[model samples]
Target: MKRITVIGSGYVGTAVACLLSTKNMVAVIDTDKEIIHKLSKQISHLDDPQIKKYLKKNKNNLKFSTELTSAISKTDLYILCLPTDFLVSKNEFDTKNLKSVISELTELDPKVPILIKSTVPMHFTDEMNKEFNRDDIVFSPEFLREGQALYDSFYPSRIIFGSKKPSLATKIASIFKEAAKNSPQVLFSSAAESESIKLFSNSYLAMRVAFFNELDSLCLSKSFDAKKIIEGVCSDARIGNEYNNPSFGFGGYCLPKDTKQLISQFKDIPNSLITSVIQSNEKRKKYISNKIIEKKPKNVGIYRLQMKEGSDNFKESSVINIIKKIKNHKIPIIIYEPLLRKQTFLNSKVMTNFTEFAASASIILANRYNEELNPYLEKTFTRDIFQEN
Candidate 1:
């Protein structure tokens, strides 16, 4: 078994570490002590059920630590899954964390291969290789959902590796294929093309979401059935149904930031479609908030802050933007997020008690539907038609 160390314990890192540990001696390194502590006890920091299951079953093969030096000895492979959040002022993803990790890893072990699974800008792998003066850096973008990250890794739709060395790339692909449950299609390409693949793949999904959301907005304005219209449109075999669900907007860690980064890469190129996708998301949120304000309810209740049903991520969630818009209209708001520990969020009262929360709000806004809200369906406002996150 290869000795592998996965840096960063976020969703991507955690999922990859768990999957690789099934057949390898895996060391998971994170800067946060609490996250490392949880994993050391065979507990997953994320809300993914598959991750938790892996931790329970594969605990013997995995080790968790806050420092990389402890696990750097004789490590055969180093995978980086650090964060690359979009910086609005710079109009690109902030790669400081990714670079820091790479710098440290190269210094600690110059000969070991480095695999980057983070979402980066187009041609970023080339830039990093040139900057570090190393050709062993490979970019393998992860196409994973927030809550189902581990499951997706276990049965990936496809596997891709972007590298300068064909032999190294092939070896890395083999490692992933061995860990995966199914024999997924594998592709090897230039580092730049692989980087582009990651950005373009997410940009396309964001566009689809924007399309369906705009359609939903039009239906709301014209008093038509969005569900039936979507059903008819997706029934066509060419379109095939996926990612057509309407919500407050496409707001998660990946879609919003990745779409913006993709646009930045279009620097001098004439493009209206991608620009429209970003605008459409903002417009959809405005439309949703306006619909809520039109009710002029005394107390508006937010059912959850998560972007999806099974996720615990609140970063860039569209619901937060909706709350901000409604707050501007001086609407009294109350949030019912069981995950929230504080008494207030964004200056609004936070209630963990569903009974009190349901009784208080004249209208409760939910981005996704929940069975718990069935009794208060009349007072709840949601765009979840199929309810299948």
Candidate 2:
């Protein structure tokens, strides 16, 4: 019965708090009133139904608070889950929140080990350790999907700890493994290596996405079956399967920023292909939008604004770029996303029914294909190389 306080109530933070609450005394903290309020009800803001179900089954151990200082009081472990949004002006991650939160926690409790699950710049933890004069700090990167945070936590593929101390690393890994996996991996390293692990992992996934998207662009241009080509290629053991679906571009929170951050780290260093990966994603979106324009469609309907399927996040989403490019040609656009109950998205009228959305638009652009748009397949414009929903 350890008292664990988790800061930041975003997707990753909420998932961590929910998962830890299964057997420990967990207090979730966030500055956002709505998020704290929702967690007080033992509910998840991720829009995932599993959270509600989990909370119903395990009700007594979880709580929410907005007061950071008080939440850290008397807690055995402090988890930092703040957002490190990619700042376009700086061309680097805005880690201001992470730095501030860590400083506050150290001032409040100097001895408490702070596990940072937030995505940060490479070697940030090592720098922080030097500045703070403490060895209790650690880094553990999270691979959470927008709406599937808890589900992924319950069955994480791997767990890596960025701790210099072997014992501390083992302690953190054991807890997570006990909650989720049978024999979860527990890799230990310096702060710099841990930070690189997260960035490199996401960048690789982005590269995979960019690769297939460019293939889709080539297929569309030459009038070939892009799906068959991908199936044949991915069938090879070297490529395997997963994340093979092509879309507007890779535009979730982690991929876009992480890829650019990796490239940014190479600003002074000699590099060609890493820089090209970032540029390629931007070019891919522009190409897809240009293809949509070439169809001579006056009205375009976006099936969903989210970056991927089963995700509630649209931050830095590629679909937004496509919309802007298409709208530049003065084409009217509509949307059909059940998650968006509002009348419009960025001024485009929201069409609730698939049939209505399909009927009104000359061309419907879908990032991921679905059977709901089956009847209008001929009129649908998509770069979904894997035809995966």
The C-alpha TM-scores of every prediction are: 0.99, 0.95
Residues 183-260 of candidate 1: C-alpha lDDT, one tens digit per residue:
999999999899999999999999999999999999999999999999999999899898899888999999999999
The TM-score of candidate 2 is: 0.95
lDDT of each: 0.93, 0.83
Candidate 2 C-alpha lDDT tens digits along 144-242: 776777888988878889977778877877777877844666678877788898988998988888888888888878988988888888899999878
Candidate 1: minimum summed lDDT over ten consecutive residues — where?
A: 67-76
Residue pairs in steric clash, candidate 1? none
Off by over 4 Å in 2: none
lDDT of 1 at 12: 93
The 10 consecutive residues of candidate 2 with the worst lDDT sum are 178-187
Candidate 1 deviant stretches above 4 angstroms: none
